[model samples]
Target: MQVEYQAPLQRLNTFGIAARARCLVRVRSEDDVRALLRQPGWDWQHTFILGGGSNIVLAGDVQRTVLKVEIPGRRLLREDERGWLVEAGAGERWHDFVVWTLQQGWPGLENLALIPGTVGAAPVQNIGAYGVELQDRFHSLDAIDLETGETFTLHHEHCAFGYRDSVFKHDRPGARGMGLRGRALITRVRFWLPRRWRPELSYQDLQRKVAETGIQQPSPWQVLEWVCAIRRAKLPDPAVLGNAGSFFKNPTVTAEQCADIIGRDPRVVHYPMPDGSVKLAAGWLIDACGWRGKTVGRAGVYEKQALVLVNRGGPQDPCSGGEVMTLARLIQTSVYERFGIRLEPEPVCVG
Candidate 1:
């Protein structure tokens, strides 16, 4: 374990936001995490757990002890005639895990290729792309209770996942049903992947890509490559620039509401949800509101992707202090005014 006081968080988050944590600790194992949690001097109220920092925005300075999880390991825990169950530590990079599965000829997670985040956070958000979601493969996870310093296993049902949300995101007040409001810290996750090949080509983008490529049944590697290519072209690279991909979640509304919006604007595109709801493209709504490529002070929406908010320049670079909440408020207000649907931010915000 490594501990530091008044540590800079600019390099820790994908946005490169300039912020400072009063105390920061890096834990490499479950035992290290439990030891820190058991310390009486450590302020549990002012402690926060962080993974890859890919889906967060640091507003200003955080006066908390930000625990950066670094536990690293992967293993095949179990296997059956149908699939294999694999376990990964919380600190593992999500993309690396996907690549590892692909190399092993496992066939699930190909559509989620190139997503930027840690494995631990995947279950929290039920991270999805193309036509698949983390929940489809998630088996269980191990989390440590911040208040008790005790670990417990959370099964798929206990997670109560709902479209980019789970027990880890909303278990606390104001978490919007994303279970991990502020109480639990994930340490490991388990996923089950099929032993045989089973491809999903439901998302319009993926289907279009397949049609354009003239491949009726694309291999897992080919599908992953296509998804990666599309993401690379659409979303800005956070390493080169500063950004957390897709600042907002696509708003899901009733089919009636979707019809109303479409009647008002024929160009509105919507995807049918499982429960008789329609998922609207938040990017489309923002673009219709003329927010695409729009800039306010140093914060601006990415020109190529309306859903992404970029720092333009590095944090503390003058061109880097755009208030994410302000931009998000604008988007929410505009979408609500135009379509009566509120846009919710997907990234975790800290101050």
Candidate 2:
């Protein structure tokens, strides 16, 4: 375990919000995690597990010790007629891992290329894009119990993943409900890419790409190229613009409720889910309320996509965490008052 006192976190987080950790420890291995747990002053209960810092907004100088997971390794554990068992350290970059799988001729993860953050954080967010979610490829994962210092392995069933949510996102007790949030520190993740991988072009953007290119059967790498292109053209790169890809979760409503919404606003973009619930386009809802390109203090809604809240101020005068949340809350209030549905943020906010 590598330790640093009063670590500067401006560059650590993708949002570019300046913050500091009172103490930061980088665990390169599971043994390192155990070593960290044995430290005298470390407080496990308050320890914040930071991955790539892509999907977070640092509220201020964090009081708790930060466990910056830096474990790194990746390999094909095995392969068979069923599928290829792949494993990666928690600290491996999510996008890099996806590209690695494609290069290795493992086609299933191609649609998720170019996403930000580390592999360990993927399951916590159930990261999805172009109709493919982490749950679709996840085999299992290894995590350490911060409270007990005991290691455990959990399969997909134990994860209890929902739309951009998992057990890891919830705090036990209070809102307990099968939540393992703030408890397990994920160390590594394994994926099962099946032998018979198929393309997922059901999403509108991908379908449009297919239509424009006239490529009926695109290769996995070709699909990856398309996904990367789509993301680049849509979402702002964190390297240049400080923003988490999507700010709000797409709200799902019953068919009757959607029907009422459609009656009131015919142009409201919505999709009928297989479960009979209609998924409303959250960005469309925000845009309909005329919030696109609007700024609130240093924080503003992205001009291109209402779903993304960006730091309008550059590094010299970066937007604070408060500004981002304030803008988010204001947007949420407007959408709720007008549309009667709450918009949940995608990133984990911390101080």
Tens digit of lDDT per residue, candidate 2, span 36-83?
Answer: 778777567888989999899988999888989888999999999888
lDDT of 2 at 324: 96
**Predicted structure 1, TM vs. truth:** 0.95
RMSD to native, candidate 1: 2.3
lDDT, candidate 1, 1-351, per-residue tens: 789999988888988888888888998898988789768786566877888988888877788889898889888898889998999999999999999987876779898999998998898889999989999989999988877787888889889887898877765555334356667788899998977767788888788887898998999999999899999989998888788899899998888888999899989979997789899999989999999998776778999989898876654572333476687788889888988888898998887
Q: What lDDT is obtained when candidate 1 is compared to the true structure? A: 0.85
Question: What C-alpha lDDT values do all the predictions have?
Answer: 0.85, 0.91
Q: Look at candidate 2 and tell me the lDDT of residue 100.
A: 92
**Which stretches of candidate 1 lie above 4 Å from their native place?**
172-180, 315-322
Q: Runs in model 2 with CA error above 4 Å?
A: 173-178
Clashes of 1: 11
Error of 1 at 165 (Å): 0.4
